[model samples]
Target: MKTILIPVDFSDTNTNAIKYAADMGCDMPVKKIILLKSYYTSVYEQILPSPDFLLISADDIENERQKIEVQLKELMKKLKNRCHENIEIETVVSTEPIVRAIHNVVEDQHPDLMIVGGDMGHELSMIGEQIIEIAKSSPVKVLVIPPDCNYHKIEQALVPCDLEAVARLGVLKGLNTSHSWLNPKLMLLYVDPKKKHIGREAEFEASVKQLVNCYECKLHYSEDKNIVRGILNFATEQQVQLIIALPGKHSFFYNLTHSSITEALSLNARHPVLILK
Candidate 1:
């Protein structure tokens, strides 16, 4: 809630995500936003035969760094203009690979959240392909913004949960701290492919009770052969603006393996998906 870290490739997908973060930063308790760009020489580029004169030099790398810095500055300026004057805007250019760059930034910034752009339909963009890895690996929570998704007030949020593993829901305990920024009515959904039910599990009910005390929340159940479809269908029907994915079997990476479900979410999702560790 205080700081957000966003890695950019300067693609349209990333641009939209930056804009979304800016809008949300203005509304939330964000104090700073860091834009990161990574630069690295690929193995192919390093090993391929080339004229000695044509080989990349220190000057070439310096020029490339300057160019990326300029781009980052431009984006930072745009965010500054869009967000509240009090919010700080910063940029980082790294000479490491994108994943490592992100890790380094996360270590250095300790951001409250990391936001990344994703396109799950057809072919995955480079950033899109890395979304799951980043979310799973990041110590901080991550928000995945679908391509072209604009900012909207999150009045309602749907959390597709695996009720059998209520312990994983502890990741959401932090939400209680951001109540004003989100202020969403929480819908905790348990989807059973075999049409099973939560039968008098005292511990499970206790966990749900604790969540109710944390936020204005309700527990719901659904029966569907396809879990991903069930979650998306419920989100759409309820008109929720955010979907929170907790770690473990019900995470995005688990569901993204199904191409059909991935495309379904890519095509139908209008809001961002928050991945909590």
Candidate 2:
């Protein structure tokens, strides 16, 4: 069975991600979902109470684990109810930080994908750094669920292509292997910010046609100044359900996160983004 590993926190992000996962499970090949909760605190050492008063004894640790296990069971029950399938849900309580725990699970469980809840237009901090690290480093594809976005079938996927991204065109064809995304129309979106064609028009069209041959696809050109906005606007206008992006030296992912005043799309996009690196 295919698995999706989700790191759980008590935030709205966790709930939204799980809901999205359950909805996707209805049509996709997702059968097993592993929910992970990492145990960590933000308090400083000096601020912590004395060991005698606050130390977690072995018994206390076990009790706490049991408590969280109950919570996880309840969470799993609720998530399963949200879907129509007989989904098998499991939970893990990690002793390390969330990111580290996720890496550990990836190495051990070999989950098919990991889902993240994206926050919009926020200041960079620990969470931002962790998200960037995971996206660039995860062995499997990483899907980001936008804020307030619900799970649904991907009817048409919006692909923002750069001249340099042709080599990674396999990302489009790979989508056809899945049940949920099988044969969804591929909208090859290219935001021609400048009116000048970079001379890769023919190559782009040919490559797209070859890769997504099993599915219907079209090449779209826009004169919007911003790359990210152009793709989102076009997706919204066309009611595209998924956005696939390739990350590399000259790709939109690199430009957005590497700029001095970064606009992190993985953290800010209003639609689910599949980062096919």
Instruction: For each candidate in turn, give its C-alpha RMSD to the true structure in angstroms.
Output: 3.0, 3.8
lDDT of 1: 0.78
Q: 183 in model 2: Cα distance from truth in Å?
A: 3.3
Query: Which pairs clash inside model 2?
Result: none
Model number with the top lDDT: 1
Give the TM-score of each candidate. 0.88, 0.83
Range of the 10 consecutive residues with the lowest summed lDDT in candidate 1: 252-261
Against the unseen true structure, what C-alpha lDDT does each candidate score?
0.78, 0.72
Model 1, clash count?
Answer: 0
Residue 191 Cα positional deviation in candidate 1, in Å, after optimal superposition = 1.1
RMSD of 2: 3.8
Off by over 4 Å in 2: 41-67, 121-129, 178-182, 198-200, 258-269
Candidate 2 lDDT over 1-277, as tens digits, reads 2888887764666578789988888887777899988775434432566666675556766777788788888898898788656678889888777778888999999888888766554433333346666777777778887767887787888878765556666765665675344467788877777865567678778877886677788988888997777777888898887887676665566556454213546434567888775
Off by over 4 Å in 1: 50-55, 121-125, 178-180, 198-206, 250-268
Worst 10 residues of 2 by lDDT: 120-129
lDDT of 1 by residue, 1-277 (tens): 7889998888888888899998897778889999988888766665564676356666777899999998888888888999989999989888888888888998888887889887754454567666656766788878888886789888899988877677777767677565345668889888876655657456566788775566788888888877777887898899898998887775544555656535644764476888776
TM-score, cand. 1 vs. native: 0.88
